[model samples]
Target: MDFNGIKGTYDVIFSLGKNCLVADQLSRHMLRKIGGVLDWVESPALPGVSHLLRNQFMNFMEFPNLAITGINEHAGCYIVRDAAYHIFSHHDFPLPENTPTQLLSYPELREKITRRVPRFLDTLRSSNRILFIRTEGTIHETAELLEVLNMQVAGEFNLLVINHAPVSGIVETPWPFPNVCALQIPLVPDEFHDNDYLWKTLLEGFHVRY
Candidate 1:
């Protein structure tokens, strides 16, 4: 399928975070126009799709302290005031493994998953089209995630994968499924934290209509 050939509105626009930057910006842009899946629901460490696939109870432990690094303005892709430890990922504040059972006791985290997961799944299952953005996952990981969707979701949907790559323009589809179309924009990995304007400009191309 051709990238530009994708027609009609999307069911949802979502990303697995290579970091929070792209998801945050994309979600906000979509919200102002068409509305979309909440981007803050993912993490910054580039957790694989398997992490999300296998775990329902996202659990977390309080970090000992927050640390700041000067590498970029966004400060390591995720930021929560004074609670900046990698352990304290925001919104979806749960670690995937070895979590103490008590951490799941937090009503906040449990309620978030309970409320959001069903809506997320329903939106995907019901929509005729979806736009999935990729920044972190490798080719294989992307395929695995899509495969899960194929099995669980009833009825077929056109998938447009907007891959943020180092080189610009159209790139080969990582998974050659007939309903899937892939496009690449010139965005080096982790660059969005420092150079948000680039991501902004790319998204700006999706003009809002009256």
Candidate 2:
């Protein structure tokens, strides 16, 4: 299960076979080195993370590597993006016309996600038994968010949840408080789950080699 000294790190270079949504996203993530499931496996092992990360789609410890043209920068912690790509790429997907994939730089992404932070904090204040923290960074930074929140929270919501995979579904996590639950209520309807059939339909047409 340990790929400690495996010879698999390489830049990603994949050709556009057919235009597909899931494939495109996977391609983008692979291009960015952020969406491949194997990347998560090679990531530093953290206690209890595998439970939230490993699912039917990406339970593999080591994925077969192919010729790649990107460095895996976030090799420290598993990315939820990769896990999401796994779930999404599992079903039958429909091919689309060739189109450009819109990628957000970390700064742009941070700004967009934080645009509503003020309004969100205002809403969080109304709830008595809950504490909410929302920050935009790599998906794995949920640990840092909780680390800071743990010290800040006095007796707020016993639940400390991080809804990082906004576009994809995530598994349940342990409650911060023994009796309290981590309430990671979504601000908007989860697009991934809301259009599950669409995703299921779109993932069927692609093959993932990483």
**RMSD value for candidate 1:** 7.4
Q: Give the TM-score of candidate 1.
A: 0.58
TM-score per candidate: 0.58, 0.23
- List model 1 lDDT by residue over 1-210, tens digit each: 665555445545655454455567765566233332334533433333444533322332223333322122233333222232132334432343213322343456446546766676676677655655555555556567677667655655554455566675446554566666666666665564644655565554443232
Q: What value of lDDT does candidate 1 attain over all alpha carbons?
A: 0.49
**Displacement of the residue 202 alpha carbon in candidate 2, Å:** 30
> lDDT tens digits, residues 42-159, model 2?
2222222323222322322112311111223323211222232221111111122111231223343234324433433343344333422121223354454345434433444322
Give the runs in model 1 whose Cα sits over 4 Å from its true position. Answer: 31-38, 41-47, 54-88, 91-105, 160-165, 168-175, 187-190, 193-210
Model 1 weakest 10-residue run by lDDT: 76-85
Against the reference, the lDDT scores of all candidates come to 0.49, 0.29
